[model samples]
Structure formats: structure tokens, C-alpha cells
Target: MRTQFGSPIDYFLELGADTIHMNELLGKPLHMKYVGQQCLNCGKDRKIYRMGHCYNCFYELPQTADWVIRPELSKAHLDIEDRDLAYEKDVQLQPHIVYLALSSDVKVGVTRKTQVPTRWIDQGANSALEIVEAPNRYLAGIAEVALKQFVADKTNWRQMLKNEVAQEDLFEFRAKLSQHIPEEVRPYFLSEKSDKWDLDFPVQKYPAKIKSLNLTKTPEFSEKLAGIKGQYLIFEDDTVFNVRGNEGTVVEIFIS
Candidate 1:
């Protein structure tokens, strides 16, 4: 699923040669048949290990390095190798941001400067604000580690999908939280008034109870498209399928 920011986020799902405009499908009946599975990384017929990677690719690819989840372990600055030093340096040595995002709750996180709104959107955050910027991922990770003592570092996915969010004054929150940042990383905190972003998703209704779909278990299903939020497709029957979770699954989509 590819997303673009808009009045409501615009979603596109590319099926072979076709790019389906998902926003236009709301309230319409759609059928999907899970044909088979393939590895997203190697493009081979294999069971996806994690997020579309084959088992071999999962352990071999630098993108799946341990540092990806634990940014604090990023050693690119020290020229240490996790998978590939060159690849790690190219990614981990780049500029990164420490931010607070409002999804189910306010959470502290770090991401590459370029990922920006994309990262926030992926987490289904309704709003976000950058609190600090660092020259590299390592520094941003350190700042995130420090801030985690005061603020949660993880998003409650279930709560986020339920749209359970509380309003917060990010400016004031950042001010209070900034005081907790370790002295070593405090210098990287942004003093300027940071821009706050509010995001809206294209959805006719939000599910009160989420019913997750597994393509591997149910090969074929049809339902009315109710909404799209984050990477999940909400159906009128209250079934929510995560397109990202089924990244390597091959499916045929039909709409009428």
C-alpha cells in the first residue's frame, strides 16, 4: 500500500499492472482471492518471515538488521558492521529526528529525517511534532532512549486501530519532556517552534471491534469497503486486513 497525504490520506494498491485508487472504492463491494505467497525481497515462492522477507533474506538483509528495531544499537558511526557496513553507514549515518506522535497516545520515536510524515502516517498517528534533530541515527537513538524514561516508546497498535487518541498540547509536552533529555543529547533538541501536523484518514466508519483477516487461513473473501486507515483495509462487516502484514501474499482483487 502506498499512501500520499491529502485532505484524507490517498491510498494506492498496485496489482500487477493496475494501480487501484482505494479511496474511490469506499462503500463498494470488493472481492479478494489469495492466490499464493511469494517473498517480497527475493521474489521467490516462499513463506514470508517478517514484513515480506523470506527466512534467508530476513537474516541476511541489512534492512532487517537488529539495529532497525533497536536504533540504540546502531553502530554505523563507529564503522562497525551489523550486516553490511556500507549499507548501514549509508542509512544510519544520515540525519534523524526524535519526535512525539499522537496515535492511541503520545509516544516518543526516532526516524530518519527523510521518512518524516511517512513514518508518522504508518503508525496511524493523527498528529505529530518533531522535538529534536540529530546529525545521525545514533544520537537520535540516544535521545529517544532518554525520553523513553518519561514517555512511551511504543504505540499500542490495538488502541491505535481503534482510534483511541487523546488530545495533547505538543508544544507544552515537548517543553516538559525536553528537560528529561540527557545532557549529552540535549544540545540537539530543537528550540524553534516546530510545526505540528494533523492527519486525516479516508474512512466512512471506524470499527468498534477489529476483526483481523489472515489471507493464509482464508483464501477468498468479499466485503464492502468501509474505510482505509494506516495500512489496514476496513470492511463493512468489521473485518480489518492489514495489507502490510500480508506483504508477500499474492491476491487477486475484484471490485463492483
Candidate 2:
């Protein structure tokens, strides 16, 4: 799903050369057939090991290095290479942001500065504000490590999907968390007097209870599309499918 920041977020689903405006598909009858898993990186039929990559790809690819998951472990900025030095420099030697987001709960996370609102939307955050903007992923990651002791790093996807989030002020959280920012990264702290970014998801109704649909168990099922938040395709029956989680999986869809 592709998202653009707006009063109400705009969502688009791209399939091959086709682009489907997903907001228009809400409340419609939806049918899905799980085809099979294909490694998105190698473009071959293979079981997805993690993050849409096959087993070998997950371990061998420069993009899937350990530093990707744990930014503090990044070595590219130190002139050392992990998998591919050139690839690491391209991805790691750039601007990064450390942020506070209200997703299920107030959480601290890191992402590229260019991915500002997009990262927040993907996490299903109701509101978000940058605490610091570091020069590279390593700095951002270290900042995250420091802030983690005071705030959460993970989102409760279940509660977030149920729309059970409580109203909270990100700016307030940012103020409170600012004291914990590591000294090395404090110079990049955002004090530009900007308001928190808020997002509105397109949903007719939120589910009373959520049943996460695993395409492996029930590869074929049809349900009324209730709403979409994060990357999950919500069904009227409370069954939700996570499109991002099943990235390498091939599927056929029919809607009426």
C-alpha cells in the first residue's frame, strides 16, 4: 500500500503495472486467493523467511544486514563494511530522524528523514513528532537506544488495529522524553516549533474484535472489506490481512 499524507490519508495499491486506489474499495465485497510465496528480492518462488525475502536472500542481501534491524550496530559511518560497502554508504551515510509516535502507545523509532510521515503512517500512529534528526542511521539508532529505556520501541498491532488508541499529545511526550536524548545526538534536536503530524485512516467502522488472517491456513476466503489501517486489510467479520507481512506472497483478488 502506498500512502500520501493528507487530512485523511490517501492509500494506493500497486499491482504489476496497475494502481488501484484502495480508499475507493472500502465497503466493497472482497475475495482473495493466496497463490504462493516468491522472494521479492530475487523474484523466484521461495518460502519467505522474513520481510518478503527468501532464506538465503534474507541473510545474504546487503539490505537485510543485522544493522538494518539494530541501527546502533551500524559500521558504515566508521568506514567499515558489513555486506556491501557501497550499498551501506548509500543507505547509512544519510540524514535520519529519531521520533516519538503515538502508536498503540507512545514509542521511539528511527527512520530516514525523507521517510518522516510515511514511517509514522506505516506504524499506525495517530500522531507523531520528531525529537531529533541525526546525520545518519547510526546516530539515530544510538538515540533510539537511549530513549528506549524511557519509552517503548514496539507497537501493539492488535490494539492499534482495533482502533483502541487513546488520545495523547506527541508534543507533550516529546518534551518529557527530551531529557533522555543522548548527548551526542542532542545537537540535532528539533526545536523548530512544529506541531505533531496527525493521520486519518479510511474506515467505515473499526472491528469489535480482531482475528488476524494467515493466508497459509485459509488461503481462500471472501469477506466484506471493513477498513484498512497500517498494512492490514480489515474484513467485516473482524478478520484482518497484513499486506506488508505477506509481501513476497503471490495472490489473486476478485472484488464485487
Candidate 3:
């Protein structure tokens, strides 16, 4: 006997279950022979048409806006290693954050650590206009701000996550994404931007400085060392050093 989607074989494998018997159907071990499709995000060979999504691609997709509200439940399907894998597939480890902002009927987000769905689930995101998972934190932040600025009043953001919006509404939101992203970073998303030029990225530089200095034994230095109990470090690197007390006074310094 066949159900609406046919036999239960595929669902069993997708869930990684050894034996799956639909309670509504006659009990028997099942297997699914599914047709494949090209993955939209990674272009991987997949049986997405019948599977709904390839497991690899599904795990790689950015978490929805609703993740922040129910992180544990939302991430329940994730195994420990899978979380790390997601990050490896879609993002890199760096100082970055992603936000799923709702503007009327749409939501938009970006993150440096977008692989961690729990981050958004903890942020109370209701839904998103677009989830921009990128390598750099700055780009993600700017993308979110762009969407917020352009689609502020046109869409109902809440309905988008709840599945209340129709397909036409999503298409409209998709079209409007161009008005948000800057031309240079537009390649990160599905749509293109009008202002196509290389953005002048701010350069960060390190300073050469001393973190600590150790001196031969002295009275004041000995007293201060006795009372201190924590991490201390001296860096001759590019970091600025803030010295307190008398500069001429000899003191001991410890660096980690």
C-alpha cells in the first residue's frame, strides 16, 4: 500500500533510522528509492526532489529566524559534530554575528558564525526577509542593516515565518533585496545589487608594545607581586601598553 508520498523507505534513511514502519501502514521494513535534483545552494548532486532536501544542503542552510525563540527544540535535530560541520560548510570562525530582522512581511539576517543556529534561536528572531550567511562579520551586519532600511514598512515580517505569506509575496520580497545590499557585497546573496564597486575595507594594524617587564628584586615590586592573583601578560607586539605608578620605579611583569 502507498501513501501520498509513497513508501516510507526514504524518510527512514533521511532520519538515519534503521527500522521505520509507519503506524498507519502495515508494519514492514521499508526503503526509499528517490529521484535526485541539483542542490540550489551548493550545487551538490542530490535526491532533493523526493527527499525535500539533500541532508548535506539542508544542514548547510542558514537557520530560520524562529531559531532564537526555541533554540534547544529548534536545534534538536543537530548532533554535536553536525554543528561544527555546518560552520565549516557555510561560514568561518571569526568575530561575527548574524541577525534575522523582520521588516513588515520579510526577515533578513547575516552572521560570521551563522553555522551555529542556536545563536539566532536565542535572539528571539520571529522570521527573516533573507538569511545572509557569509565569511565576514561586517558584511553580514551590513546586509541586515540594508534590508532593514529598504523594506521597513512594505512587508509583514511576522507572517513570513509562520507560513502565512503566499509565494507571490516571497517573490516580491526577493525582488526588493537588491535595494538593500551594497554593490560590492552583493555576490554573497542570490540577488545582484546596482552599485557594483569594490568597497574600501578598513585596514586593521597591530602595534609594537611591551606587555610586561621583569626587574631584579626590589621592595615596592615585591609587595605588589605578593598581592596580585590573576592573569598578567607583557606583549612587545603592536598593542598599546598602559603603565601605572612611577615609570622610573622598577617592577616585575609576567606575560602569558
Candidate 4:
């Protein structure tokens, strides 16, 4: 899904040639039918092992390199190849941000400087602010590892999707955490604090309890879309569907 930052984030889903304006589907009955599957990499009829890639594509593609997940393992700076050196250098060598975000709780994270608010929005963070601007993913990632020892590095997805959050000032949190930044990365820390981003999701009512929908498990399901937050489609009957999670699964959805 793609998002446009707004008063409430506007979400879009691209399928084939169609662009689904997900926010418009709110409060409408949606019928979804699982049709088939296709690997995002080679477009083959194979089960996706990870990140919408088939087992082969997952292992073979430069995009799915281990450094993608554990950026600290990146060797692109040293001109060493993990999968594809050119691809690695292109992405891993780009400017990256080490940030503090509040979703279910305050957490430290790393992302390309370009991902910015998109990364935070995808995690359903209520607020976020950059703490460091590093030259590459490795620097930002190493900073993340150091900061995680003091603050969380993972989001509690259940709590995030349920809209259970407490407001907090990221600016103050960033200051307290600055002293703990690894000495090597300290030079990149931002002394001039930028205002934290506060995002509003278009949720009509939040579910007290949530039951996840697995198209593979159930195959066919129909429910009224209550709202959308992050990548999950909130439904009236408390069934939530994760669009990004079901990346390679082909399905047909209709609304009325």
C-alpha cells in the first residue's frame, strides 16, 4: 500500500493497473475471495517464503539480502558483496536516519532518509522524530542496535493496530537518549531538534478485540470495513486483514 500524508493519511493499494483508494471503502461491506498466488520477484506460481518472494527468489534476489533486515551486517561500505554489490551500494550507501517513534511505545529504528514519515506511518506510529542523520544504513543500523539496549526496537503490532497508545513527547525522549548513542555515531546526532510528526489515522471505531484474517486459512470472507490503519483493514466484525503481510497472495475483493 502507498500513503499520502494528510490530516488523516490517505492510503492506496496498487493491483495490476488499478489503484485502490482504500480510505473510500470505509463502512462498506467488502467481499474478499482468495484466488491464487504469485511470487512478486519472478511472477511465478510459487509460495512466497518472505517479502512476497518465492523460496528461490527470496534466496537469490539482491533485494532480499540479509543486510536488508540486519543493516548492521552491510559490507557495501567495504566494497564487499553480500548478494549484489551494485545493488547493495545503491541502497546501503544512501543517507539513513536513526529515529525515535511512538506506536505501542517508544522505540528506536533505522530507515533510509527517504522513507521518513512513510516508515513511521507504516508502523502506525503516533509520533516520530529523527535523532541522527548517518551517511549510510550501517551507521544508522549500528546506532539502532546501541539504542535498543535502552529503548525498544520493535513495535507491539497488536497494541498498535488496536489503537492503544499513550501520547509522549519524542523531542524530550531524543534528548535523554542522545548521551547513550554509540561514540562513533555521536557526530551525526542532530543538536537542533526538529518537531515530531503527529499522524492521525482514519479510524471510526477501534476494536476491543481483534481476530486476524488469513486468506489462505479461510479462503473466502466478507465483512464491512470499519476503517484502515497502517496496512490492516479494520472490519466491523472485528476481523482485521493485513494487506502488506499477504503480499504474494492473489485475491479478489468487491465492495457494496
Q: Per-prediction count of colliding residue pairs?
A: 0, 0, 27, 0
What tens digits encode model 2's per-residue C-alpha lDDT throughout 1-256?
8998886788888776888888888989988998998998899999999999999999999998999989998989999999999999998999998888887988889999888799988888888888888899899999999989988999999989988886777777778888888888889989665967888988788888889898889989898888888888888999998989989988888889
Q: Rank the candidates by lDDT, best first.
A: 4, 1, 2, 3
Rank the models by TM-score, top first: 4, 2, 1, 3
How would you encode candidate 1's per-residue C-alpha lDDT over 61-84 as one tens digit per residue? Answer: 999988898888999899889999
The regions of model 4 sitting more than 4 angstroms off are none
Q: Each model's TM-score?
A: 0.96, 0.97, 0.28, 0.97
Better of 2 and 3 by TM-score: 2
Best by TM-score: 4
lDDT of model 2 at residue 197?
A: 83
TM-score, cand. 3 vs. native: 0.28
Q: Tell me the lDDT of candidate 2.
A: 0.87
Alpha-carbon local distance difference test for all models: 0.88, 0.87, 0.33, 0.89
What are the RMSD figures for all models against the true structure?
A: 1.3, 1.1, 25.3, 1.0
> What lDDT score goes with residue 220 in model 3?
20
Residues 209-245 of candidate 3 have per-residue lDDT tens digits of 3223333122222111110100111122322121221
Total colliding residue pairs, candidate 1: 0
Error of 2 at 146 (Å): 0.5
